[model samples]
Target: MAEDTLVRVEHLAKKFCRDLKTSLWYGVQDLGAEFVGKKKEEDIQLRNKEFWAVRDINFELKRGECLGLIGRNGAGKSTLLKMLNGLIKPDKGRIEMYGRIGALIELGSGFNPILTGRENIYNNGSVLGLNKKEIDGLLEEIIDFSEMEKFIDTPVQYYSSGMKVRLGFSVAAHMKPDVLILDEVLAVGDSGFKIKSFNKINEIMRDAAVIFVSHSMPHIANITNKVLLMENGVVDYYGENITDGIERYFGLFAGDKERVEYNEFATIEDMKVYASAKYADDPSRKLPAIDYRDPIRIDLDLKLKPNVEWFHIKLQITDKDLKIVGIYDSFQFQEAIKNDRDLHHLKITIPNSIFIDGEYSITVFIQQRDPINSKWNLLAVYRYWRKFNMKASAGLGYVPAVVYLPGQCEVV
Candidate 1:
């Protein structure tokens, strides 16, 4: 390990048995082997009903680095974090730590339920190797940062989930440990507090090594210099290319089939996305990649019920996170919809897209306006109707915004 390295993991692996009885039996066998001063080959092999929660994971975090651990649920991210925090022992491999560690792996994990918040702060400070006078100096600051000064004397059992998160993160933030391990505890706090917490994390990253586990890509991209993507208890991708890591993480999700809601008065029979002369005709490509800001053309074939006339259409574009980025309405263009026959073919063109480099999906909505009330009735909704990928025009590094608009600078 380097002198500046605060956390180092080497081929770390851990396994668990599904059945309790079998787990106990395996434990006993492992104990017997240990007592006899002999290593069992089976220790490295998976038995029946046993699986590796985290396997062969290796990473090193030096003093001013933050590592993003991201993956789908049940991908062994939490398990790996627990091992690094010493909450659980690894079945194999080694973890080397150099200095004091602070971890917020679970909400209210280190708190005493019966103890008052004030007392818990002192207790946590003591656990972090801070003396009484040191903790006294930081007590008020911690309370203020947590925004729980009013409830400082209240018992922790009465704290809500958000309160617990605030208190827990406050202590961890102020402790200033050499290595910080944070799970998704920040997700529980309110928007203001989350913002505050990220700011604090930014401050800490300059002085300590951080291992942050989060499902939010924006958060991962914002804080982590490098990323480790896990899948099925193993390393799927690990590198400093945060964009590539995020793209691979999005690729793990199989695009959901089009979902209909409300009245199924219309159905999208076929949908195709086109960029320039290249027609997205490959069935194997889940999301066809296109150059950024390329003119996009969407062709949709819809089958509508009889008597449905003068209906409006809406196209909603969403990023890989399923967050709505932009929307286009047929009413804006005043494009008349001719429902003379039951089937209809509509082509929508985007002269130039402003979306940044990332994955995006489209959702379609069909509605009818009541002439008397002037209110629109949702006729159909096709969720996750189409998906596409946009490649960056040039390597401009990381632009946090969703859309990239061309701009000119003027020097006067």
Candidate 2:
């Protein structure tokens, strides 16, 4: 481990039951019973099998640096976080950390649902190594920060889910440990609270190294000074910023430079992603950047396999904060087609009138369907947020707000 490393993880692995073999056996057995009548209770037994959730992964967190963790669902982010916090032991590998740590690994991992908010505060604080006097000094500030003052004496069960998260985060935030690990806790609570919570996080970020896991790339880009991408149990890429990590993530499955000829679904058999709509060229410049009161365009060129339905596509624009700005769907508001064709050239153009002045980005989704209701196809997705002329608040002397709406008056 480097002297600058605050935490180091090497050859870590965790496994879980996957593809219940017994379920398959029973399911197969049931197929025979369809011809024989009701399944005989005495003859059937259920079975489950185990699989690796994470394997042979390795990485290090430098002091005062922000590291990101990203993978598809079930790729073991939460499992890795648990291992980092010493809440769970890895089936393989070792992790070493230097110093007092604070983690809000999940929304509410250490709380006692039955305890009063007041009691839980002390309990959690004590666990974090605060003496009773120290806890006392910080109690009121925690309650105030959480905005759960009214419910301080109430049982935590009586609190709403947001309240619980606020309380938990408030405690963790006040502890000010040497290292902090934040999972996707930002997804919880109301928008206003989320903003407040993020501000608090930024405060601690000045000194503590933060390990963040989120599906929200925009946040990852803005907050993380560095990144490490994990794929198939390996540290696929690690860099000075989030963009490099994201490109590495896309490359693992997309592999834009390679030609893949095999696909189980005919709808996607010929679907080769020559270049992403977001990354028409270099991905470093491809991050989403929507200027307020300006138009944005997403062009798509695709060749589809036969036996595919007319596809519906959706393009969503969001502010840098990862809030939705506008949604454009093919079936709802863009170009359309009636036949199952081999190729398509389509573009979605967003007029400047829709958004409030802010920094924003784009995400696209596509599915197959008819005019009435299109059943979604799973293969299409693209996200851009960090790279852009898309932001800048139209500050390029284009006050020109999100909309002109003509016929203006001269200040009555």
Residue-wise lDDT of candidate 1 within 220-285, one digit each (tens)? 988889999999999999999998888799889875666765546888888998744453565665
What are the lDDT figures for the candidates, one per model? 0.87, 0.66
Residue 253, model 2, lDDT = 50
Candidate 2 local Cα displacement, residue 327, angstroms: 9.1
Task: Report the number of the highest-TM-score candidate.
Answer: 1
Residue 209 accuracy (lDDT) in model 2:
74
The digit string of per-residue lDDT tens for model 2 on 1-412 reads 6776788888787655456775467457657876788654343333357556677777777776788888666667888889889987665678889877888887667888788989998998888888999989999899999998888898887777788779888888888677888888767878888888778877887767788887766567667777767665556676774555754554455222222233233322222222223345565653444443455655566555565555666666564444665677777765545336666766556555345433444455555654466455544555541123433333322232333343456976
- The candidate scoring highest on lDDT is 1
Candidate 1's TM-score:
0.92
Clashing pairs in model 2, backbone N/Cα/C closer than 3 A:
22-47, 287-387, 288-384, 288-385, 289-390, 290-390, 367-377
Instruction: Specify the poorest-scoring 10-residue window by lDDT in model 1.
Output: 275-284
For model 1, the local distance difference test gives: 0.87
- Where is the poorest 10-residue window by lDDT in model 2? 267-276
Candidate 2 structure, TM-score to reference? 0.59
